[model samples]
Target chain A: MTQTSKKPAAVEALGLTKIYGSGNTEVIAMKEVSLSLARGEVVALLGPSGAGKSTFLTAIGLINPPTAGRIVIGGEAVMDGPRALVDLRAFRRRHLGFVFQKANLIPFLKAVENVAIAMEINDVSPRAARKRALELLDYLGVGDRARNLPDALSGGQQQRVAVARALANQPSLILADEPTAALDSHRGRQVMELFRQVAHEHGSAVIVVTHDHRSLDVFDRTYEMEDGELGAKHSPPAPTANSTPSA
Target chain B: MNLAAKDIRHNLGRFVLTAIGIGLLLMTVLGMSGIYRGMVDDAMVVVDRIGADLWVVQHDTRGPFAEISRVPANLEHRVRAVPGVASARSFVSHNVQREHRDEPLRMNVHGLAWPEDNGAWVTLTAGRPLGQAHYELIADASLGLALGEKLKLGKDTYTVVGIAKGMVSSGGDGLAFFTTQDALAIQVDLPGDALRLERAARVQRAVAQDLGQVQPLLLERGAGMASGIPALGPPMVSAITVRVAEGVDAAQVAATIAAWPDVSVHTRDDQEALLVRGMIDKARRQIGLFRVLLVVISTIIMALILYTLTLDKIHDIAMLKLMGARNPMIAGLILQQALLLGALGYGIAWVLGGWVFPRFPRRVLITSEDLWALAVVVAIISVFASLLGIWKAMRVEPNKVLA
Candidate 1:
C-alpha cells in the first residue's frame, strides 16, 4: 500500500508517566513516554506482553489519568500535568472511541442498538442515533447484520459491528487495544484493514496496540515498543513498483 | 431510553417471576387491611340501622353489648315526659344460646313492647311481625330459620313469625326480637324440673331445722309464702333505647337523665366513638406488629431478587460504564426495571384481593379508597427497594470490565 504524508497531528502526548502503589511496593508502568499521531493515519503499536502498551493507551483514552503528562486531542488541551482540563467522561464520549480485545457489545442489545448506545450516552435522540448507526454499519459493509445480536454473528462480523459502533459519534481519535487478538489471522487482518479504511475515510487518527504481526502491512505506519519505549519504525514495501508516488 | 427497555426484554422471565412474588405478598396485605375495615363497618351496622338518637341504661355502664346495664321499665314514660321529647320505648337485650336443628346458635334476644312499637328498628324481609306478646318472635335472616319454625330458648318454644335483615350485635351474633314479658321470663325462668328440685331442697332444709334454730314455723312461712309468687329480683332490662324529639338536643337529655343515680344516657355519636375507640385501643398493637413483619419480609425478598439480577449482569454493567455511560444513567436503568416490576405486582394484587377476599368465611372488606391509598404506599416502597440496587450498580468501576 502506498502511504501519504502525515496529515498533521490530531493527538499528542508528552512526558506520560504512570506509577502503581507506593513506597516499597511501588512499580512504574510507563516512564516519560512521548508520541504523536496525525489525522487519516493508522499507527500500529507492536509490543510483547506487559510492555506498558495498555497503560499508554488507557492514559491517552482518558480513562486512566496519568501520574503526569500533557495530552491534547483535536486541538483541545484536555490534560495538563496529570490534571484533567475538561470533563473526562464527557470529553471521552464526544472526542474518543475505543475497541477492546473482545467485541464487548452489550449482550442484550441488537447490533444496531449496540452501535446507537454510544450516541445515546451523549444525549442523542433514539431515532437519530439509530439512523446514523445504520449508516455507519452500511459504510463498514455489515448493514445486513444490523438486526442480529452480537452472539448470533461470526467473530469477524461482531468486530465489524464494534468498529461501526466506535465510529457512530464521529469521534476525533479511535483507540483499539488488541482488537484483532481474538480472531484468526485472516479475520484479524480483515479487521485491521477495516480500521485503516475507517481512519482514512473518516479522517480520524487511529492507534492499534497488537501483538499480532500478520496484519502489520494493513497499518499506514508501524512503531515497535520494547520496555515502555517506542523503538524503531519499519515501513512496509509498496504493493507495486509503478504505483503512484506517495502523497 | 434504549438500555432500560432492552435490559427488561433480555430478562423478561426473571422480571415476571419477581413481580408474581410481590403480587402475592401485596394481596395478603390488602386483604388484611380490608378485613379490619370490614369488621368496624359490620360492628356498627346494627346501630346505624336502628337510627335511634339516644340510648338510656344503668348509670356507669357502656350499655347494649359493651357492659351489663339495667333500669326500671317505667323510665320510658319519664323520658317521654321530658320537654322536646318525641316518644320513647323500653328495650332489653341479652345474649342467649338456643338450639336450632340440633345446632347450638348464640343470639341476642331483644324484648320490646307488644305489637312491636319499635317496628322501625327492623325491616321485615319475610313474614309478619308478632301478633301476640307470648308466642311470637322475629329472627334475623342470618339464622337461616323459616317462619313457623320454633326456637327453644330457656325452656320456652317461641315460634318465628318474621324475618329481619341487618339485625346483628357487635359480636356478629344474630338478633331475635320478642315481647318484654317473654324476654323477662326467659331471663329469669328455670326449667320445671330444676324449679321443683329447688322447692324440694328448701322444704327438706326447713324440716331439718331445729326449733331453736330460728323457729321452724317462721322458716316455713316466709314472706309471700301463701301467695306462691317468687321474691322480686333485680331490674331485668339490659338497656333502654330512646328516640328524642325532632327539636330535642340529645346532649341535654343525656345530662338530665344522667342526674338519676340508677341510669345513664348515651347519644348515638357517643356510642359510635366508644365502639371505634374500643377496637383501636384493643387491637392496634397487634395489627401494627403484623404490618411491620409484612414490610420486612417484602423488603428482603425484593433486595434478594434485585441483587441476584445485578450479579447476573455485572459484566454488562461494567461494559456499559466503560463505553462512557454515566453512573446515573446506568442506575436509572436498574431503577426503572424495579419500578416496572412493582407496578405489575400491585395490579395483580388488587385484582386478587378484590375478587377473592370477600368470599372468605370471616368478613373481609376492601374499599376502593383503601385500595388506591395502598397502591401509592406500595409505589413508595418499591422505589425505596430499588435504591439499594442502584447504589450497588454505581459503585461498580468500569475497569472491572477488564478483570
Candidate 2:
C-alpha cells in the first residue's frame, strides 16, 4: 500500500506566552497557550474581557508579539520562542489579515480604495489591485457601495467593506477582533455566517474573537478562554474500561 | 486617490478654515516685505529723480536723509568749475508744517535753481514745470491740493503751477518745489513769537553790559550798527548736485571734489547705496525679523494642526499599520496633508496680496521673484511642520487596532 503524506496545519501555536511588566508588577496575559487550526477552518473564540483572546489573536497575527512562543502558518515557521523567523512586517502584509471591533476603514478612502490599497501596498499593479478589490466587493455583496466613502455607508455595509479589505490580499489567515460587537443580532449572525462562507470558499483559516455567544453554532470548532487559559469546548472523554481513543 | 486630496475633500470645511488662517499669517509676512520694499523705494525716489551724476554734501555726513548736510550756496559755481562737471545746481530741502483748512499740513519743501533753459528733471503729471520759480510751486497730487490752489509758505503764498504724481520725501510726506529764495525764507524765518522773543533777549543782553544805560546804538539799530558791523546775508544751500559731462567718469570727478573740506561728494551709485543700505537697512531688518517671527509662528501653528489632525485619526493610522503600511507610507500621508495646507495658504495669500496691497497707503510691490521665494519658504515650512505628525504616526502600534 502506498503512503500519502499529511499536509501541515494552516496555523500552529505552541507555548504562547505574553507577560506584561516585570518582577513585582508582572502580569501574565497569556500562559503557555497552544492551538492549531487547519485550512478552511472557521473557529470562534469566546471569552470574557481580558481573557487573553485578543493577546492570542494579536500574537498569531504578528502584531503584539508573544513573549515566548513558536507560530507556524502554512508550514512556515514565522516565530520561534519570541524571535521572529521572518520579516514580521513583510510576512504580515503578505499572509495575515485583520478586521477590528469598529469597521476602521480610512474615512477618506472609498470602499473600493480601502480594499485596493491593501493590494497596492503589496506591490500589485494599481489596475489589477482595483480590479481585485471590485471583485471582492462584489463577492462580499458591497459592490454597489464601492464608490461610497465610509461615512456614507451604513454600519453593516462598512463592516462588509472592511471584510473585503481584509481579504483583498488573499491572506492565509483572517483574524477578527469582535468584528460584530457593534452590529445588531441579525446582522451579527449574518456576519458570522459570512465568515464561515469566506473561510470555506476562499480556503483560508479564520479566527474570530467574539463576546456574542449566539453565533457559536456557525463555527466549525469553538474555544473558551478564561484567565489567560485556552481549552476546546468539546474534547474526547478520558479513556475508561470500555472506552478507546484514536491518535 | 491621493491621500492629501482625499483628506482635504472629506474635511473641506476644517481644511479651508485652516488654510485661511495660515493665509492671513502669510499675508502679514508678504505685506511686511512689501512695506519694506516701499520704504526703500521711497528713500531713493528723490535721489533718482534729481538727474544728478554726483551729490555734494557735508564732508562727514552720509546725505540729506541719513544726516544733515549744509553747504554755502556759492558752492554751486565752485562745483560748476570742476573739470568734468557739466552743470551744477544748489538745492535746499526742508520739512515744514503749516495751518491749512484748520488742520496741520506737513510737507517736504524742495528748492531748485530753475534755469531759463528747462532745468527741471522730475516729471509733471498734469501741469507744466516751474515757469516762474518765485511764488510758483510744483506740488505732489497726493497733498489733496488742486492744480491752481495757493499754498502758503513762510510769509508768502505760492500758486501751484504744476502737478507731479508720486513725488514725495523719504518719509512719505507730499512734496512742493520752489525757488531758492522761498525755501531759504521758509528755512530761516522764525515765527512771530520766536522773533519777538529773540529781539527781547538781544535787547536785554545789550543793556546788561552797561548798567541802567541804554545806548543810542541799542535803541537805533539793535546795537549791531554801532561798530560798522555787517549782518549775515547770503543764504546757505542744503547741498549742490552736479551732472557729469557725457564722456566723464562720475566716480573720478566725485573723488576729486570729495577732497574739498566740508564738501562730501558722492556718485549716483554711491548715493543710491547710501540711501538703500544705510537708511533703509534698519527698516529692512525690522521687516526681515517680523517675517521670520511670523513664519515661525505659522510653522508652529501648522505643526500643531497637523499633529492634532493626526491624533484625531490615530485609530485609522493603526488600522493602516495593521494592514502592513510601512512607517514611510504613514509619514507620507501626514506630510502630504501638510504640504497641501501650505500650498493652499500660499496661493490664497499671494492672490489677495496682489489685489489688496495696491489699495494700501504705501506702495506695495509684489514680484514674481518674491512669490517664488515665498513658495520655497512655504515648502520648507510645510515639510518641517509635518515632522511632528510623522513622528506621531510612526509611533502608532498596529496592535491598537486589534484592541
Candidate 3:
C-alpha cells in the first residue's frame, strides 16, 4: 500500500499566554491557548464578549503579540514570545490576511483597488497586483462590482469585496472577526460558505471569530472560548452545543 | 496606486478650500516682502539715477536722504576743482504739498543745474525733459501731471514738459525736476501775509541796529526790494553730486573731498547704505515683523488643518496598518497631501499676487529671488506642518481595526 506524506501545518501556536498588566493591574486576556491548523481547514471560533477570541486572533495574526508563546506560520517560527525571529510587520504583510466586522474597505479606493492595494503594499507591481485583484474579486463573485466604492456596495457585496482584499496577497492564513455580523442570515450563510470554499480551493487555513452558530455547518470544525480559555473543538452536527451569541 | 492622490480626490472640495485659505495668507506674506523690496528700491531710485561718483554734503552729517544737508550753492564749483573730478552739479530736494484740482498733491521737488544738467539724464516715459531753464519741469507720471500741463509752485507757474516713471522719493512722493533757480525761488517764496510780516520784522530789526537806525530809508528800500536777498548769505543747496573722470578712482576723489573741514563727502555706495540702514530701518523692521508673523500664522493653520485631516482618516489608517502597510506608506499619505497643499497654495499666491500687487497704493516688487526663497520656505513649512499628522498616523495601532 502507498503512503501519502502529511502536508505542512498552515499555522501553529504553542502555550500562548497574554497578560495585560502587572500585579494589581494585571488581567490575563488569554491563558495557555494552543492550536494547530492544517492547510485547507476552515474553523469557527465561537465565544462571548471579552472571551479572548479576538486577542488570540490578533496574537496569531501578528497584530498584537502574546506575552508568552511561539507562533509558527507555514512551518517557520515567526514569534518566540514576541521576540520576533523575523521582521514581524513584513512577515505579516506577506503571510497574513484579515477581515473585520465592518467591511473596513478604504473609502477612497474602489472595490478592485481595495483588493489591489493589499498586494501593492507587499511590494507587488501595480499591474500584476491589479490583475490578481480582479481575479480574486471574480473568484469571490463581486467582479461586477469592482468599480464601485465601498459606500456604493450593499453589505453582502462589501463583505465579498473585503474577502477579495483579504485573499489579494494569497496569504497562508486568513483571520476574520465577525465578518458576517451585519448581514442577513442568508447572506451570512453565504459568506461563511465562501470562507469554507476559499479555504478548500485556495489551500489556505481560515479562522473566523463569529457569534453566529446558524452557519456552523459550513465550518470544518468549531472551538468555543469563554473566560479567556478555549474549549475542546467539536466537529459539525454539534452546533447546538455552542449557543448563539448576542450581536 | 498613490494613496495621497486618491484620498485628495475623494475629499477635493475640502482640500481646495483649505488650499485657497492658505493661499490668501501666503499672498499677504508675499506682498509684505514685495512691499519691502519696493520701498528699498524706491529709496534707491534717486540715488542710482543721479549717476554721481561722490556726494558732498554738510560737514559731520549723513545727508541727502538720511538727514538734513546744507552746503553753499557754489559747492558744485568747489567740488569741480577737486583732483580726478570729471564734473559737478548742485542737488536740492524738498517736499511741497499744494492743492491740485481739489486734491492734495504732494511732490518732492528736485533741482537740476539748468544749462549744465537740463534734466537730460532723467528717463522720460512721455514728452520731453526741460527744454529751457526757469519754469519748465519734468514731472513723474505718478504725480498725475500730464505733459504740457501747468502747475503753480510759489509765485511762478511751472509747465510739465516731460513725464518720468518710477521717479519718487524714499517716502514715495513723486519727483518733479526743475532748474536750480526756480527751485530756490519756490523754496524762498512766502505767502503775501507772511512776506509783509517778514518785511515788518526786518525793518524793526534794522531800527534796533545802529546801521538800520541810521539807514531807515535803506531798510524801507530793502523791504520794498525783495526782503529775501540771501539774508543768511548765499542760498544753500542740499548737496553736490560729483562724477569722477574716466579711469580716475572715485574713492580718491571722495577722499580728497572728505578732507574739507566745511563739508562731508560720501561715495555713492555709502550714500545708499546710509539711506537703507538709517532712513527706513524702522519701516523695514515693521514690515519684516508682519511677514514673519504671517508665516507663523500660516504654519499654525496648516498644522491644525493637517491634524484634523489625520483625525478624519484615523480608521482608514488603522485599516491600512493592519493590512501591513509600512510606516513610509502611511506617513506619505499625510506628507504628500501637505506638500501638494503647499504647492497649490504657492501657485495661487503667485497668481493672486500678479493680479493684486500692481493695484497696491505703494509699489510692490516681487523679484525672482524672492519667489525662489518663498518657495523654499513654503516647502519647509509644509514638511514641518505634516509632522503632526505623521505622528498621529504612526501611533495608530493596527489592532484598532479589530476593536
Best by lDDT: 3
Q: Looking at every candidate separately, what fraction of the true A–B Cα contacts under 8 Å does it contain? A: 0.42, 0.63, 0.77
Docking model 3 quality class: medium
Q: Per-residue alpha-carbon lDDT of model 3 for A73-139, expressed as tens digits?
A: 9999999996889987888888898988899999999999999999999999999999998898888
Q: Considering lDDT, which of the candidate structures 1 and 2 is the better prediction for this target? A: 2
Best model per TM-score: 3
lDDT of 1: 0.78
Query: Candidate 1, after superposition: displacement of residue B148 in Å?
Result: 7.4
Error of 3 at B132 (Å): 3.5
Minimum summed lDDT over a 10-residue window in model 2 chain B is located at B223-232
Clash counts for the predictions, in order: 0, 0, 0
lDDT of 3 by residue, B1-403 (tens): 9999999999999999999999999999999999999999999999998888888999998977988899999888888888899999999999999998789999998999888888878889988878787889899988999988888878889888999988878898999999988888887788899978877887777888898878667687657646345455777889999999999988888888898899998888998998889998888999999999999999999999999999999999998988889999999999999999999999999999999999987889999999999999899999999999999999999887765
**Tens-digit per-residue lDDT, A183-242, candidate 1:** 997788778878888888889999899998777777778877777666677796454332
**lDDT for each residue of candidate 1 in B1-403, tens digit (9 for 90 to 100):** 5576788788788788888899888888777777667667767875686667888888888876576777877787788877766667777777888667888888877787766463445788998877786967889887778989987777678999899976766666777888887987788777777776766666666666674256655445432232353343444676667777777677887778788888888888887887777744355456556766776777677767776777777877877776778887888787777778778888889877778985774467778887887788777777788777887888787666666
User: How big is the positional error of residue B113 in model 3, measured in Å on the Cα after superposition?
Assistant: 1.6
DockQ of 3: 0.69
DockQ value for model 1: 0.50
The lDDT, on a scale of 0 to 1, for candidate 2 is 0.82
